[model samples]
Target: MKCWCGKVLIIDTRRLESKFRDDGKDGLIEGVNLKDRIERNMNASSYPFRVDDSCHIFRFTSTGMKTIEKVVVFDPLPIPGIYMLVLGDFDEDEIDVGVKSNNRDLEMVLSTVVKIIAFFLSDYPDASIFVEGSSAARNRLYRIMIEKERKNWRELFVIKGIDEDTFEVFQSGKNYSSYLISLCKT
Candidate 1:
């Protein structure tokens, strides 16, 4: 299947299923160094998270001025090995990506999302994750965060920025409409 960035992805479903079954025996797939995933200098504090049976959804809570529930979903795209990283507030059994929580914990919330990404990649190392903000402002926020930690993340991930039908290696000063990230082949 062709991803939005025009890259073709061919996945082996049987291999993925077998790997999942083997690693999920304990109800969790392990293989990432969570402590090293985020930069310490960035105030990268995170909340505890819970994962659903399928491991596609992760839930956590944000606390500051007010308590707000949040969820990160790894929704699979039509292509087998491609997934979208969705971050949103969980409200009344629905996910509202555009909701402004006003919780005053953007760093912590983003840290939690990064941790979730680490966990998800541990299970599907070869899979590509697509990320785009719900709005232009949010997109800028994401770009800023990525720029701040680009060097720190380079060892673990291959990050590509999408600009109008072109995908290029992520650069600090360049702005991108979206991003694609995958585990770096060792």
Candidate 2:
């Protein structure tokens, strides 16, 4: 199945099932140190999400001045064990990722995204989730959200930002073209 982002989701169910079953002894990537974890308070709120049977897709409703159906898809990338996080509105028969729903619920939507990420990592602890916005402005928005939650999230994830093909530890004030997140070793 091909996603709206044009990336073909070649889901090998057997491979995924096996990966999910394996113990995550080697989950943490090299070069990440335990001292790098950040601690802070996270007081964000989110809408409850419903997961599909495959657990690759999640749905939630955004309620504010307007009601919008939202879909979050964790599509497999070409690289093994990596997936791209796609967020979009659930249009009829398709997910329109480019559409900007001015629902005035940015914080709730982002908080819900974080919740979904946590849930996805619980099943695929070693998998790295990639996120890149549909537009430059949207990318900036994502960066801002990440920065706001960086300290709180660092305790749970090893967040990295990609700039000019280089993946470095995510830092505030630095602009990145994309982001990668994986479960932090407990």
- List TM-scores for all candidates, in order: 0.76, 0.76
Write model 1 residue lDDT over 114-143, tens digit each, in one string.
777867886788888999987778878888
Highest lDDT among the candidates is held by which one?
A: 2
State the lDDT of candidate 2 residue by residue for 1-186, as single tens digits. 677678987655464234232232343111112212221234576776666556787777899788888878899999998999989886544557878888899988997788788778867898999999887788889889988887688778888999787889988888888999898877
Q: Give the C-alpha miss distance for residue 60 in model 2, angstroms.
A: 0.4
Clashing pairs in 2: none
Candidate 2 deviation (Cα RMSD):
9.0
Task: Give the residue spans of candidate 1 off by over 4 A.
Answer: 1-43
lDDT score at residue 174, model 1, on the 0-100 scale:
79
State in Å the error of residue 34, model 2: 25
